[model samples]
Target: MSNRSHEVEYEQMLLSRHGLWQHKGGRGKDGPMERSAYILLSRIRVQGPMSIGELSDAFGLDASTLNRQTAAAMRSGLVERIPDPAGGMARKFQITDMGARMLDEKRDYFVQALDKVMADWSDDDIAHFASYLRRFNSDIERIEGRPWPRPGTDGP
Candidate 1:
């Protein structure tokens, strides 16, 4: 198939997966957290506390939208706002212990679901697929000029 055709197929698959994840209780909650909430909590956990402006840039979202989202998270006790640890003027959001526990649970659930889906695949095949997926995400981040902090690396 042509590269363009393959890209279209890939996009379709991604949309399908997203739909399933969002609507099918794939996050292990009958009413899963909003996608934005999950991503925001996950990012804060991985990259440490971050300001709304910084998150806006990273997620390509407006500060006001993030403000509302963070407010909701705060109300839920999933995150807390504090002075920037780096001594910046703007406050940053940090995930709470409850948030971390929830994130870990959701991650485990997702992994279990993936294991079931890929049960027939060999270890080498799984590793290769993971490598390519990471590369794809990295390339997109590079193009967007907002690279995500990779785990186990000293990130800027």
Candidate 2:
């Protein structure tokens, strides 16, 4: 949890300081399109409705940059501006139902990719790995003031 340990982990995983950017999941994408899309969708899916400012903070980006990206998402009907769950003047941006469906599709794609990559492993191996991974992630979340990503979560 210290700066030194965090940097080491980032160096090992090729992750940025925020843990959103990683090299492992960057394969087979047109530029960073797939990565950007996946990360954006992941935040929206995990955090639920959020303001443009909140998204900017979560992704460590500028407002104008998200404005452009979210404009495209809005045009595609994948993202929508909605009443802020927090109830503020700023509108909360949320993934539409269509967006959620697309997220599910991408989730399946990632799951399939993971399955193929881990195909040699036995069922017990898969289950064991999954359990430990969950525990590791839960500990990280406890440190970060965030909840583990999953359905029915209160936050991302």
Candidate 3:
């Protein structure tokens, strides 16, 4: 198939996946936590505490939108605002212990769901697919100049 055809197919797949995430309770239980919360928590977990402005730049979201999302997270006790370790005027948000636990649980559930869906695939096939997906995401992040921190690494 041509590159254009592949791009179209990938776009459709992403749209379908997004729809599933939105309509299905992908986060588990009654889905009390919003997807944005999960994403923000995950980012903080990996990158350590970050200011509203930093998160805004990282996610390409407006400060007002992030303010609302972070406010909700704080209300739920998933995150807390603390003085920036770097001694900045604006405080940074850090994931709480509870947030870390919840994020871990949600991650495990997501992995299990993927396993069920890919049950027919061999281990090698799954590994290759995962590698490709990672590469694809990395390329997009690089192009957008917003690469996420590598897992287990402190972000810049």
TM-scores vs. true structure, each candidate: 0.86, 0.64, 0.84
The digit string of per-residue lDDT tens for model 2 on 3-105 reads 9888867775762343333444443332233556667878888767778898777766799998988887777667898787776899987888777776666
* Model 1 regions lying over 4 Å from their true place: 1-20, 23-31
What range of 10 consecutive residues in model 2 has the weakest lDDT sum? 24-33
lDDT for each candidate structure: 0.82, 0.71, 0.84
Residue-pair clash count for candidate 1: 0
Full candidate order by TM-score, most accurate first: 1, 3, 2
For model 2, the stretches where C-alpha displacement exceeds 4 angstroms are: 1-33, 127-152
Query: How big is the positional error of residue 98 in model 2, measured in Å on the Cα after superposition?
Result: 1.7
Descending-lDDT candidate ranking: 3, 1, 2
Q: Which candidate has the top score in lDDT?
A: 3
Candidate that beats the other on TM-score, 1 or 2, i.e. the better one: 1
RMSD score of candidate 3 (Å): 2.7
Instruction: Evaluate residue 47 in candidate 1 and report its C-alpha lDDT on the 0 to 100 scale.
Output: 91
